[model samples]
Each structure stands twice: as structure tokens, then as C-alpha cells.
Target: MKKITLWLAALCGGAIMLSGCNMLDKANGIILYGDEEKVLSSLKEEHKGQVEKDSLSVKLMDTDGKRLMIMDETSAQYLLEKELLQEVKDGRDTEALSSIPKLAEGEAFLFAKKEDSDIGFDSLPDQVNYEGNVIIGDGRAYADMFLVVADEDFTAFEAEAKTMGIIQYNKDPDGIGGFDVEREQLVKIEE
Candidate 1:
């Protein structure tokens, strides 16, 4: 009976650890690594020889540690919702967290179809909430990736996106363009 009880406790502990791991993964948007360079390195490793070294571009980076957007000549922009972990894994330096850019206190990340157009919020899951001042991009460069502040957890929002479809730039607003949340709500990011 003693051995059996110990085994059960061990099983429960393992289960809890696994659950925590999954939660940590979900907290960050799509992927999380030490820093932007690590992120780029991981991408190169994942894609192997296909990714070019000089064509990478950063569309956006949330200094608050919530999101990141990068693009390469070979693929669409990658929107990464990310946070720097308290502990660095694999001997990576925690100091890299300082590299992320910052925004004004009340300002948060937002996506505009273009500098002149309205903010698109219709396709996101109804559960995701965002209300705050937005800081628009520089407009000098071509930006394709976008990330908006979400008041709620992203699991449901992300799940719904996968179930319906992830937002794409060129896709028309056919009830499917906005992360599949339904309805087409477009408001200007700034007044």
C-alpha cells in the first residue's frame, strides 16, 4: 500500500508539471525563445537551407513582451505573441529580454489594414477583448504582420482562429478574414 500511494503521488505530480508546461506554452503566442536572434536562429534551423540569411524583416516587436512580428522573403510575416521567461533555458542569457522594444504606457499593439484605413477587429474570437490607445507603425516600410492587445486569455481566441482560419492580409472581409470570430468590425486605430 505504501509503494502504491507513492506511485500515485508521483503520477499526480507529473501530470501537474505537464499541465503547467502546456500553460506556459499557451501564454506565449505561437513560439517563445530567448530573444529575437534566438527566434530567428530557431526559424533557420526549423526550415533548414530554405531560409535566406539577409532577407529577414521585423514588422513589429512589442516591448511589453506580449508579441513579435517578423517576415522573410520566402514566407508571410510571423506574428509571435511572446513573453520572456523568468528563467533562461539551455544556458541562454536572461539579459536578452532587455532588447525588446517598448511603447508608451497606455499604448498597446494593434493592427491596421493600412496607415490610412480602419482597424479590423471583426474576425477575432468574441472572447478576445481589446480597448486602449493604439500606436501605429512607421508606414515607411512594408509591414504585413499584425498583433492587437487581447484583454482575455488567447487559448479560445487561438483555437477559434485555427477552427475557422487565421487572418490574412489579402483575403477580403468575407466573414472569414478576421480570425474567424464572425462579424466585420472595422474601427480606426486612431481618431
Candidate 2:
């Protein structure tokens, strides 16, 4: 009986250590806004292409008319369209979003419904910047989601989880994997 208990305790300790290590690996790096000036400077340095701007956003497109990026002034975000990302992954335009900084490696962008005031990043730290609300989802069931740039070491995730609720969101239908979010522990939405 004593040996069995010791073995079980060792197993539990190993699991806990594994989970802690996984969390550390997912630790977010610095979350910075996509500045238009920085983007333009990079573009000029790389000699990519021209930029088009309307009242809504500033667009950067390649000479072949492939939309590379969109910088939303209101939200202060640089979004890479999905089509471009796919093309790049398929070995077509390998240098598609190279101009933009690749600071989103370990970080995860967790959003909350703007209407859900009861649950949100109320006490965001000085490092985490609220980047305004933006519309998410492509279907008719669109949602107004609030955005925030979480700091490195996931301090924002910890703060939000303590104040609101955190959930794991699985975006793909293949059941591959998911990321942590606020409000619920698990959610799988087909896209």
C-alpha cells in the first residue's frame, strides 16, 4: 500500500511539472501596436510596393495586386489577410508579411465580446494596451470583439482570468488544438 501511494504521488507531481512547463512555453512576448510609420519605413527599406489609404484603413499591396496587409487606424492593428497567409504557406509569396515584425510567435490574441461588459480585461496592466473594438467573424453571425495587446509572460491572461473567465478555444474543425481565452474553460467553434 505504501509503494502504491508513493507511485501515485510521483505520477501526480510529474503531471503538475509538465503542465507548468507547457504554460511557460506559451508565455507571450511583448505586444506592440502595428505602427503605420514603422510599416512604411520597412516597406521603403525593402522596396515592396505602394500603399493605399481610405477613410477606414491603410492597405499595402504587392506589385502583383496581392493584398499583403491592412493597418486599421482606429484599432491600431496590422492584420494579415487569410488568403495572403495561405498563399505564402503554399510557397507562392514566401515574403508576404515579412515587412511586419514577427512578434506574435508565442503570443495569443484573446478577444471578448464587446457587449459582455461583465467579463473583460477591466484592470489591464500598463504594458497591455487596449487596441479598441473591431468586428470579428466572416459569417452573418458577426461579433464585435474588443482587442488588447497582452504583455510578455502572459500577465494580461492571468489578470483577465482572475477578474473574468478564461476558456480554451478550438478554432479548427480538425480538433488539432486551441488557445486560452476568457469566460469559459473550453469552447470549440467551427469555422
Candidate 3:
């Protein structure tokens, strides 16, 4: 199931972007799947020597500790609708109690969810409650790895990504030619 999800993300992310970043809502977080062993390509030729499959998993790391978590999209959406999020007329202000990994090369992300368990671990099953995907700020980067940020924090994430030489910012409204990551600054596309 996990491998299938990652494959879907890799296959779909590119296609989704082609529809234009306009399809994304800067204020909302999205479900993402990424393979750690694979480096992302702005160009296709660089992918020649890499193996096609890698194990994909969701993870969470913070002051408390790091652990493997579950992905439950419906649960995520429920959390958003039930009013667990911090009120912000523009962009979401909720904290990511749990997250999963996605993105490529140095770019990576942790799809978000609320920690609603007594143990505060893992994905919530449907009978209980669910958490929705939320955009998390910069993930801890290592070597060539990078992080993905929500529309709420695009400006700040952009500045940090630049310093790290990470050139991509998904769904930046200010992106240029659909390859906004190549641009020095973003031009937020209005809905």
C-alpha cells in the first residue's frame, strides 16, 4: 500500500503541476508522496542510473522524538472541518501533530495531521477521527535534501530554500513559467 502511494505521488505530482500551480490553494495543505532514495529532476536525463522503486514511509520528528506514522486523508480533512485548526481568514495556522514524507531531491514534505490520541501516536482510524494534510514548514534537511512549505509560509520558505540552494517552491503563485523554483522570487498566482 505504501509503495503504491509513493508511486502515485511521483507520477501525479508532475501531472498536477502541469495543470498550473493555480489548481493549488495557497491556504490549503495537500497529500504528497515522495521516495527518499530518488533525487528530483528539473530535467529528465539525470534519472538514467537510478533504481525505479524505493520504500516510502511517513515520519514525524520534533523535540519529543521521531516515529513512523500512518496516512489517513479522510481523517485529515475531518480535523480541518471540525474546527481543530487555528482560525486564520487567510492560510492555515494549525500545528502538525503528525506528518508523512513526500517530495524529491532535496525537496521533501511531511503531510500533516492532528495528534488526537491518548498516546498521541499514529493515524486515527475512521471510527474515531481523522487528520487532513497540512503544509509543514521546512523539514530538517540533510546533504542534498530540502523541505516543502505551505502557501502561508512561501515567502519565508523561499528565502531559506535559496540559502540551501533548493530552487523549488511548489504552488508558489509568483512562480515563473510553471518552473517557479528556477526563479529567484515567486509571483503568487491569484485565484
lDDT of each: 0.28, 0.27, 0.29
**Whole-model lDDT, model 2:** 0.27
Better of 1 and 2 by TM-score: 2
Q: Give the per-residue lDDT of model 2 (tens digit) for 1-191.
A: 99999999999989878543333322111111123343233223311121221111222222232212222322223323311111122221122222222224233232322323333333333332322222222111112233333224333233212121111222212211221221111111111
Q: Candidate 2: minimum summed lDDT over ten consecutive residues — where?
A: 182-191
Query: Model 1, residue 24: displacement in angstroms?
Result: 39
Pitting candidate 1 against candidate 3, the one with the higher TM-score is 1
Q: How accurate locally is residue 134 in candidate 2, as Cα lDDT from 0 to 100? A: 28
lDDT of residue 42 for candidate 2: 27
Question: What lDDT, from 0 to 1, does candidate 3 have?
Answer: 0.29
lDDT by residue (69-145, candidate 1, tens digit) is 32221222111221111223233222112222233222334333333444343433333222222221112122232
Instruction: Return whichever of 2 and 3 wins on TM-score.
Output: 2
- List runs of model 2 lying over 4 Å from the truth: 1-121, 127-133, 139-143, 151-156, 159-191
Best model per TM-score: 2
Residue 10, candidate 2: Cα error in Å is: 75
| Model with the higher lDDT, candidate 2 or 3 | 3
**Please, what is the TM-score per model?**
0.20, 0.21, 0.19
